[model samples]
Target: MMMNKMREIYGVVNMILFPEDEDPEMLSLELFSSFAKAKERSEEIIKEFIDDYGEDYIEHVTKKNPVAVMGNGDVTGYVYIVKTHAL
Candidate 1:
């Protein structure tokens, strides 16, 4: 038998770094279970990025989303999610 599961909260980090005239290099990192966890990880990522690429290059945003995921142990499902304003 299948049952509905509680919606999961996820945090996403998006970043773009490059000169205006050049192509933007963007990275999307996801898979965190909570906003705090996501933010914490993003901070670490930001530090590393800044150290390697410099603070001047980064355009950063953290997106918090609540996702309704449907599935069974067999792995068939759909994900419905909404994105909240960036922080």
Candidate 2:
């Protein structure tokens, strides 16, 4: 008998701001097998946004969703950090 193994996947969600548009663009930027790497990438993105627009213009959002099963039978639930304009 063989047992199935479960693993966690980490991802970053980016909200790109447009000066001319009222709505920001949202998308998944990257995926990682380790949370540390995902978090580092999120920080990098935040820093870039701050460097370009200033801290007052950037907002951080976090969301946690329920676990989802992929088509290949891999289960994943993401806790993502998003960068967007300050509201």
Candidate 3:
């Protein structure tokens, strides 16, 4: 049998890819935010999007957006969420 070269479909992404010690299906490169903090951020950021755009802003932008990052996370580089139908 011949060996094929492995490809980095996600590219040289700086963030941790999925199938990790935690959630294997998808590696969450985002820093864990407290409930209150998340709520505040949602209000500050998404509220504006909803007002400027519409209530469907989150639904439209998040559906298969393939990324979730935080400016405060260690994933301080070009982070990317790899797409996969399998685990």
Candidate 4:
């Protein structure tokens, strides 16, 4: 079978093209807040995740918009929730 290779590039990436079988899914929770507050909450969530899991599981860059925050379509910052378990 052919393997899917991942590459890192600079600038904004529109999509993640990881294969499903190769990329196992994990449970996560994300909280969105204003740009001014995103980092604070991200740090808090990271601490909580470490307390519960005994380690860090934040897959992407912290305090960045890894996923779109969909609500009223307003552009807001996000804090990605990390955990140790998969569901």
| Candidate number of the best TM-score | 2
Instruction: Kindly list the per-residue Cα lDDT of model 3 for residues 1-87, writing each as its tens digit.
Output: 122112223321322453334542223223323556787986898578678668775565556445545577555444334243443
Lowest lDDT 10-mer window, candidate 4? 23-32
Over 2-74, each residue of candidate 2 has an lDDT whose tens digit, in order, gives 2212111111111233434332211221232356687889899879877987775443233333345565566
Clashes in predicted model 2:
0
Q: Model 3 reaches what TM-score against the true structure? A: 0.30
Which lDDT tens digits does candidate 4 get at residues 30-50?
Answer: 122254388888799868867
Where model 1 places Cα greater than 4 Å from the true spot, the runs are 1-33, 59-87
Q: Rate the local accuracy (lDDT) of all candidates.
A: 0.43, 0.45, 0.47, 0.44
Compare the candidates by lDDT and give the number of the best one.
3
Candidate 3: residue pairs that collide: 19-24
Ranking by lDDT: 3, 2, 4, 1
Per-candidate TM vs. native?
0.29, 0.31, 0.30, 0.28
CA lDDT, candidate 3, residue 49 = 62
Better of 1 and 4 by lDDT: 4
The runs of at least 3 residues in candidate 4 whose Cα sits more than 4 Å from the true structure, single-residue gaps closed, are: 1-33, 56-87
